[model samples]
Target: MDELDEVLPPEVTATLTEQLAGWADGAVTLAPRIGVALVLLGLTALVAWMAGQVLTRLGRRTRLRRNLVDVLRLVSNTAIWLTGLLIAVTVVFPTITPGRALTTLGLGSVAIGFAFKDTFENFLAGILILLREPFRIDDTIECEGAEGRVEAITIRDTHIRQTDGQLVVVPNAQLFHNPVTVRTDQQFRRASIICGVAYGEDVDEARAVIEKAVRAVDLVRDDVRDIQVFAHAFGASSIDFEVTWWTGSLPVDIRASRDQVVAAVKRALDEAGIEIPFPYRTLTVNAPVPIRSVDGQG
Candidate 1:
């Protein structure tokens, strides 16, 4: 120290040497702790992977829902990783007790929560949705005018495959807050279509014909519910019958059933001489107007 002071300023040399020695001691002491922390982290990762595999096998054996099993695995892995990290931190810094570490974490969480409010909201909503399970994977659902089949549900969002082959990722919060229509909640659903016949046709006969036709549709489930045909409204050129029947709940099933019913009803009405009239419009003018020919001849 005295020799270095001869070449350099006493204050600067003494401070620099003390700092260098302190850093060297810190490095020597911290090296083993860092190595231990790294080993612990590796063990944590290995354990997390093993836990995931075990949970997956248990889920399969127990026949649990796939989404629920995934949720459990995610939660378990997070907890294990957090525990390992906490232990590693304590090993490195003996001054930081578990209570102090937790308090610090609580303070940090407040800031993190504010930064990722939507993410946490969606995560909580996802957990709730998984528990409640109003609809399942492959079930058809409609929400906010978007209709599709549910392909997957995760901690953040849900995947829906639309009929036109588009994939929609909907946030769990939206689903939890809004009203969702589960189309396939039941095995069968009722469908209705307006069938109009000429005003001159008998209402009772038209109703009977529509009922018989709808019931004959292959996709129609008459065993579950009877087909119904009622006089609904009067049109300018025809009387409308509300033809309703029960059929499979899936969208494809309903569409196919409708096609068959429409074809059968048209054929039945044609055979019965009941004309399904088209709209007839008449224009009335207050003043008389002269008509002209395309060739300008009267």
Candidate 2:
């Protein structure tokens, strides 16, 4: 300090020397606490891992849903880590007690919640979804114009593999608030298609033919539910029959059954000589002057 003062201004030298000394003393004082905090955090990591493993095994043994098990594991890890961090913090700074830490955290959480309102909403919704089991992974669902199989349900979002092979990450809150159509809620579902025949075709006969054709479809679950054919509407050219049958609930299953039913209905109608009509047109000219025959006579 005396050498620095001789070469430099006394005021600057004094201030610089004092700042360096203070920082060194502070670091030395903090080193042991920092080491202890590190050790505690290491222990926290181990405990969190152990807790996760235990929960996973317990869930499997108890035959809990996969998503529910995941939620349990996540919550356990979060709580353990939070507690461990609080303890480590208090050790590093003896001035911060658990009560004070909690109070500070509570206030911080309010700000965090406001800043991430949607995130919290999604997290809560995800928890409810896991608990309620409204739908499961691999179940096909339709919501908000997105239709697909559920791949995974995390705390913030759900992963859906769409029918066309696109992956969609949908926020959990949206699903919780809106209506979700679980296509595979049951083993089988009812599907209907309109089959229009010529207006002159017998309605009763068409209905019978359609019911028989639909029942013959390999994918149709006629044993589970009856095949139904009702005279539904009259069109410009044809009388429409509402053909309905029970089939597998999956989208692929429905599509396959529909394909077979359409083919079978067409084949049956053709064999029965029932005409599936096209629109017919009639023309009348206001001033009809002449008519020409094959020989061009008028």
Candidate 3:
């Protein structure tokens, strides 16, 4: 150490020591600023959360649609956080002017938008969905081969609870771009079933029986319209009748009504001696040739 110190000039060593001391002093001075920045960030997050809660509660109190309420809450929360972030940045860097900050943000946003194109696409789609409300929460919807009730809608995805109890998270872009079928959009939905009877049984009689049977189901609604029964097609085994009825739009209602209709139809057909025939196949063999003795043996 003494040899290296002797090789170096006294002036250079003194300059290096002074620079190290300045750096240490600068670090000490900046520590408080960094701490204040962290505190500002925490406060910003807290304020954003509080704003979200208030907006959500207020939205719920109004008559606004659920999706619209969520959207409003989201927008308000975002605005609050953005304001907080700007303030925190200004506090941290006292010399950065707001105009310069905005300009920098504008440039940064373009790069971020390109980098996260799909994410931004879903976000925009989600906002539009919340604004337009194609389907509401708990609405039964079919889209992209996934049939389920909407559980929740968020900025990036929609949560759907399937009939088999599976939860699916679908991107908002897919929902917005594709066609969705809302099965429970109306109060009543049409339920149809095909029933077949033996060809000998009268088609008109079968139709009458089916109409009566389906109408008798408690879940089936008869006040709006009468049940419709029509001869749909001649099947391989039995003549088919397409019976249509109005029922509650829910899946459970449709299933229960169908069960009742099927039971009632079976009972009515049995009582009336109308046979629901199964497919029957007939095979015939021509008279077999007389057996001949092998090797010319009679």
- What's the residue-level lDDT of 30 in candidate 1? 99
Per residue, candidate 1 scores C-alpha lDDT tens digits across 1-298 of: 7888899998899899999999999999999999999999999999999999999999999998988999999999999998898889999998998888889989999999999999999999999999889899999999987789999999899999999999999999999999999999999999988989998888888888888888878899999988889888887778988888999998988898999999999999999999999866899999989999999999
Give the clashing pairs for model 3: none
Distance from true location, Cα of 194 in model 2, Å: 1.5
Global lDDT of model 2: 0.92
TM-score to true structure, per model: 0.87, 0.84, 0.76
Candidate 2 residue lDDT tens string, 172-269? 99999999999999999999899899978788888888888888789999899888898888787889888899999999998999999999999999
Expressed as tens digits, the lDDT of each residue in 1-298 for candidate 3 is: 3564698888777787789999999888878877887898898788877877777787777766666767777787777777767777777777886778888988999999999999999999999998788888999999999888899988789999998999999999999999999999998999989999999998888778777777777888998778888888879888998888899888888899899988999998888889989867798779876666787666
Q: Evaluate residue 151 in candidate 2 and report its C-alpha lDDT on the 0 to 100 scale.
A: 97
- Residue 185, candidate 3: alpha-carbon lDDT: 97
Point out the worst 10-residue segment of candidate 1 by lDDT: 232-241
**How do the candidates rank by lDDT, highest first?**
2, 1, 3
TM-score, predicted candidate 2 vs. hidden true structure: 0.84
- Runs in model 3 with CA error above 4 Å? 1-8, 14-50, 63-74, 87-95, 287-298
Local lDDT at 106 for model 3? 89
Alpha-carbon RMSD, each predicted model:
2.9, 3.3, 4.8
lDDT of all predictions: 0.92, 0.92, 0.85
Count clashing residue pairs per candidate: 0, 0, 0
